[model samples]
Target: MRRTRRDPIVTTVLTLLVGALLAGGWWALRSDPAAPAPAPAQAPPAAQREVTAQHSRQADRPVPRTFDRSAHSTTDPSSTWVIVNKSHPITPSQFRPELSIVRGYQVADPAAGPLTRLLDASDRQGLGFKIASAFRSYGYQDSVHKQLVAAQGEAAADRISARPGHSEHQTGLAVDIVTPADGRCDFEPCFAGTPGGRWLAGNAWRFGFVIRYTPENEERTGYSAEPWHLRYVGPALARELRETGAGSLEEYFGVPGGDYPPVP
Candidate 1:
């Protein structure tokens, strides 16, 4: 052993290697078990979380097989129009009071003029028919909503009154007629019960009007039976609707025609 001399370079390298190993061992031994773990990945911000939740809720909702154009029909070409209440109130202004003139009447669309004449003529025939209501503006609808909420509570009023921007009155194509007081008209037996209401239901189509709602089609209209409501679809379509006995414009057109989708 005394006879061998190690190279300085080799001696230095060996010393460095031993020192590194010792240091690493010491470091491992001294490591603390109590060190905190890294924080979990942060969740999305609150706004983003809310948006995600909204999307999830929408996805869970059922899709309508058909389109209900009642609200949009007057404006959307693809939609077919229908009537609302026929006899409960007359004049379009009653349904849309905000647009009423000083005389308390609302203007009718030019297209509705002919239909109105026809309705008037039908009334003279002892049909007990009258224009119950017509074009409604957004403001009138809001007022109606308030009145209905006050009178019937929110839930019940929701069934009868169209929500603002979701009313047929906006379209200028809808009209309600009077049900007869007696049985002398062409109206059905049901119409005699509400004589003016009945007369219009039986004969509205001849004048290019169709009962937009009916008892058989409650599922589509989102309202109870409304025999007096009529919608002017022009003579051609009116005839078709009448022949088909389709209770709702939704059913007649094979689409949904209101705020909600047809019941599943």
Candidate 2:
């Protein structure tokens, strides 16, 4: 007996079904097993950076050159003028004279209303202090500077004279205290020698005043010791400066010592 031939359609259907099953099994077996998980994304860098104004300003600032103490002449006597070489030059006429009083051929102005009140309070406490000089004109400084130069060499004059606009007097916030004879403007050794000077040195901050130049800060101020000179920087700031004993305003403000004019 002869076997019967199967139908072509049925044979094709069976062959396709088997192939599908084999493909599925092969894919399942070949797939990776126990694969590690992917890592997390990294964070972006910070957008902000820290910078200080002082650091930026330092680049533009002018470094002070070595001064020839012997070569420079003092203020000219024949000419009545004041000129500040540091920062810029300023004339006496530019100063506000309305807020000041004249004493010993120099101007004296209270720093502000609050400071004046404080000064009054100090006076009531038996401090007995008076402002000797304030708000000097460039012309006045020039004439005096020249006289000092004539009397002494440039170095000595620089120790005592402030070039015009650079003076704290131009800011109307500084004063010179009167000594016992007015002739003796001795601002060294110790302010404690006089009652007024002593009281100021102790309590000037209460009235927004500070010794402009101190012995320790001679290099920063570009001048020798001066205990008579007082600068008004407000009670809060003055108190801070006094406590820190940082020497001069330049140092307190982070300015290079050589940039400021000599203490006059």
lDDT of the candidates, in the order given: 0.56, 0.57
Which candidate should be chosen as best, given TM-score against the real structure?
2
Worst 10 residues of 2 by lDDT: 45-54
Question: Residue-wise lDDT of candidate 1 within 1-264, one digit each (tens)?
Answer: 377889999999999999999999777667956655557698775435444544654576565222222323433421334333221122343343223221133434433555657656765776655454676676878899999999999778877777665666665666655444543432232553564565666766776677666667666666666666666665545655565556665565565444443337
Q: Candidate 2 residues 1-264, lDDT tens each? A: 999999999999999999999998777666846444456476322111111222333455565322212121122211111112243334443554445433333333335564567557766876655666666766777788888988998778766687655665765556766544443445555664666667777877776677767778776666566677776655545655666676666675554544444469
Which candidate leads in lDDT?
2
Model 1 TM-score relative to the real fold = 0.53
Q: Provide the TM-score for each candidate, comma-separated.
A: 0.53, 0.54
